[model samples]
Each structure stands twice: as structure tokens, then as C-alpha cells.
Target: MADTNAQEDFSKLTADLAVLRADVAKLADTLTTLARSQGEAAADAVSSRVRQGKAKAEATASELMDEGRAAYDEARERAGKIGGDVTAVIERNPLGAVAAALGVGFLIGLLSRGR
Candidate 1:
């Protein structure tokens, strides 16, 4: 009777262990699937953010380039007007312009000799 009872108890313990192992395996698989899903979601979010940032950067660069071009055009126009005014003055007073040029050359030569 003792031997028979021990054998029955051993069989029950073995069955319980097998069920526990199956449950653990199911839990592991569930955790693996959850981790994979979360990782994919995070990757997708990062990719979306990167695309938005790139587009914003490109737009900002384009706007800055347009502003720079406008500034350059305005400066060029001002310089051209100033140059025309100077040329008209020089043409109207050729002898005075020659005297001014000779004065500037004398001053530059004097300064350069000191250097």
C-alpha cells in the first residue's frame, strides 16, 4: 500500500511540473510578441519625426536663401547708383578729379615709405 501511494504521488507531481512548464513557455511567447510590437512602434515614431525635421530644415534653408538673394539684389542696386553718381561727378570735374587722385597717390606713397 505504501509503494502504491508513493507512485501515485510521483505521477501527480510530474503532471503538475509539465503543466507549469507549458504555462511558462506561453508566457515567454507573449512577452516576446509584446516587445517586438513596442519596438516597431518606437521605430515608426522616430522615422516619422526624422522626416518632419528634414522637411522643416529644408524649408528654413530655402527661406533663408531667398532672403539672402533679396538682400544681395538691394545692395547691388545701391552700389550701382553710388557708382553712377561718382562717375557723373568725375566727368563734370575732370581737373579736380585729377588733382584729388594725385593727392591720394602722394599720401599713399608717403605712408608706404614709413611702413
Candidate 2:
């Protein structure tokens, strides 16, 4: 009777160990799957943020380019107006303009000699 009882207890212990090992393996697999999904989610979120930042930067650069073009146009218009006014003054006073030119040239020559 003692031998039969000992044999049965040994068999029961062996079966419990097998079940425990299977449970541990299943737990490990679940943890690995969960980690993989979380990593993928994080990567997707980072990519989305990068795309949004790129779009915003492009829009800002476009606005700056437009402003630069407008400033260039305004400067060119001002230069044209100033040139027209100078032409009119020269037309009104031909001899006086020539005298002024000679005076400027003489002053520049004096300044160059000093330098």
C-alpha cells in the first residue's frame, strides 16, 4: 500500500510541473507581443509629428519668400521714381546741371587728393 501511494503522488507532481511550464511559456509570448505593438505605436506617432513639423516649416518659408518679393518690388518702384525726378531737373536746367557736374567733379578730385 505504501508503494502504491508514493507512485501516485509522484505521477501527480510530474503532471503539475508540465502544466506550470506551459503557463510560463504562454505568459512570455503574451509579453513579447505586447511590447512589439507598443513599439510600433510609438514609431507611428513620431512619424506623424515629423510630418506636421515639415508642413509648418514649408508654409513659413513660403510666406517669407512672398514678403521678400514684395519688398523688392517696392524698392525698384522707388528707384524708378527718383530717376525720373533727376531727369526732369536736368532737362529744366541744362547749363546749371553742367556747372553742378563740374563742381561735383572738382570736389571729388580734391577729396581724392586728400585721401
Best candidate per TM-score, number?
A: 1
Return the TM-score for candidate 2, rounded to 2 decimals: 0.72
lDDT of each: 0.97, 0.96
- RMSD of candidate 2 to true structure, Å: 3.1
Candidate 1 colliding pairs: none
Q: What is the lDDT of candidate 1?
A: 0.97
For residues 67-102, what per-residue lDDT tens digits would candidate 1 score against the true structure?
Answer: 999999999999999999989999999999999999
Residue runs of model 2 more than 4 Å from their true location after superposition: 1-10, 94-115
Give the number of colliding residue pairs in candidate 2: 0
TM-score of each: 0.87, 0.72
Count steric clashes of candidate 1.
Answer: 0
lDDT of 2 by residue, 1-113 (tens): 99999999989989999999999999999999999999999999999999999999999999999999999999999999999998999999989999999999999999899
Error of 1 at 60 (Å): 0.9
When summed lDDT is taken over every stretch of 10 residues in candidate 2, the lowest stretch is 106-115
* Superposed model 1: Cα runs more than 4 Å off: none
